[model samples]
Target: MFSFYNGFKKFAFAMDPETAHHQSINLLKRFPLVLSEVFRNENLGGRYGVQVGNLHWDFPIGLAAGLDKNAEAIDFFTRINFGAVEVGTVTPLAQEGNPRPRLFRYVEEESLRNMMGFNNEGAEAVRTNIIDSNRNGKVLGVNLGKNKLTPQENAKDDYHTLYGTFAPLADYLVINLSSPNTPGLRDLQQKDTLLELLSELDALRLAFPKPLYLKIAPDLSFEDIPDIVDVVKEKKLEGIIATNTTIMPERGAGGISGRLLTEKAALVRNKVLECVRETPEIQVIGVGGVSTFNELWDFWKAGGKAMQLYTSFIYKGPKVLDEIKHGIDSVMAQNDLKSVQEILDNINHISKP
Candidate 1:
């Protein structure tokens, strides 16, 4: 499989990244189970399962949003063995995002910079895609965002509409206010604004409830993390996804992800975890720059549960999942732990990666 992907990567990487991404999505949209089966991890079973809010993931790592912005290829992603699949940054209407050269890759660094300003096929089409998808019992989350044209005051309305549309369809839902490409999107991350937006959703949530999470940025002030945690607590959210990609101006425009985001993301994750330490119900879904089993180990040590990866999956492919699964097995064997729950139960006592 590794060799196959390497050969495939050589071909895929030769093309423009966005072009290659679209081609991959187009192929998956054909719904070829044979191709999906080739990448399936047969060993992923109940033992690897972990709980994230009301939803249960077959494994820890999930495909983050952006890869399938339209949820056009759910069958391939679910079957490929990610514990969960999240789609969108979807808005109420379709968008073309930024112009050409929006996706830039840092090959040697295993990083990516995207200025893709939440471009997606809008709610109705995406809702149709979600209805048509085969989740394979793995969790599916819809990451929602306001339309690029939506005024900041009307942002809560967009979210309210999105939550109502997706709540019944997705196993979980994420309110994505942290993507850097959209103008003034990150401003919603401020404590007062964050609280206001979520508070406005209270009625809609009561009408059609789902496991909800907030995806924040790594560039936030560390001092403000607890206040964000407070907002989560105040609004009765399921958790926070610590981090969407981060801004790196020196690298030029757009948000930086992958290896370029690891350290800052880790710091933010740790800070959020610390703030939520006393409130175990408010879990943190780790994302951004997390690529290895050792990093997963650190996350567990700090009380994190499920994680999501996009950039690493791009650079290393399915083998990365195998590596983490093996790393878990090694720790389980060394500590006589039979399940991921057991490993988490005795995370400190288990062998580090």
Candidate 2:
């Protein structure tokens, strides 16, 4: 599979990034069941089982948001053996996203930068796709966000509408307040704004039950993390997805991806883990610059309960999943650890600053 992907990349790289993405998605959708069957074996490689809240995933590695924002590829990805797939940054209404050339590749860095402003086929269209496809067995998480044109003060209403519409279909809900592409989106991460946004969402959760995760930025100040922790605890949210795309270094118009942000992500993960470790109730999902097995191990070592990927998948293809899962298992065996959880417990003690 990887050999073919490499050969394909030789041609795909020449095309525009967004064009390549659409082409690949179209291919995946054409033979969804066949693709899923091809990758379904346990030995095909991925962390076999991981638990988050009430949901139990078949693997810890998953395709992140922005890949299938409209839920068009849900059936396709499900067949491919991902433990979970997070779809959307879906808005209250449909959007075309940013203009053309919004997605760019820095081949030298093995990274991608994009300012795709939460474009999607709207919540209602995505809901119809999911319902019609009937791809419900695999764990599915829906990432929700406000429209680009929506006012900051009106953001809560947009989220509330999406939550009500998608919550019944999602195993988990990710509040995407972190993507740098959307204007004023990251500002919602501010202490007071986050508190209010999450407070309203928390009240909504009572009427509709599902795990809620706050997606945060990797570029946050040290002082801001504790405030986020306070809000999570106060609102009784299910978890936090530490370290979204970074806006630092000013990579033109969009946020940069891949290895550049790994250390920063780890720092934030450690901080959040330290703040919440004593409480032990808050779950953490780590993402950012994770392209190697070592980085995945480091994320768990730093106290992430689960981890996700996006850029790495682009660089290494599906083969990276097998490599990381096998590497983690091998390292666990070398240390005489009985399970991934035990390895995580051992490292959590040693990796802390």
Q: Which candidate comes out best when scored by TM-score?
A: 1
User: What digit string (tens of lDDT, one per residue) describes model 1 on residues 1-353?
Assistant: 88777877898899999999999789888854876766656577678889887678889889998999999999888887799999998999898898888999999999999998888889999999989988887899999999989999999999999999999999889999899999999999999999899999998899888889999999999888888999999999999999889988999899999999999999999999999999999979999887888788889998998899999988988888888888888888888889998998997776753
RMSD of each: 1.0, 2.6
Q: Model 2: which ten-residue window has the lowest total lDDT?
A: 39-48
Judging by lDDT against the true structure, name the best candidate.
1
lDDT of each: 0.89, 0.80
lDDT of 2 at 161: 95
Residue-level lDDT tens digits of model 2 in 95-159: 99988888888888887888888889898998897777656478898999999898999999999
- Per-residue error for 181 in candidate 1, Å, reads 0.3
Error of 1 at 28 (Å): 1.7
Model 1, runs deviating above 4 Å: none
Where does candidate 2 clash, by residue pair? Answer: 36-79, 36-80
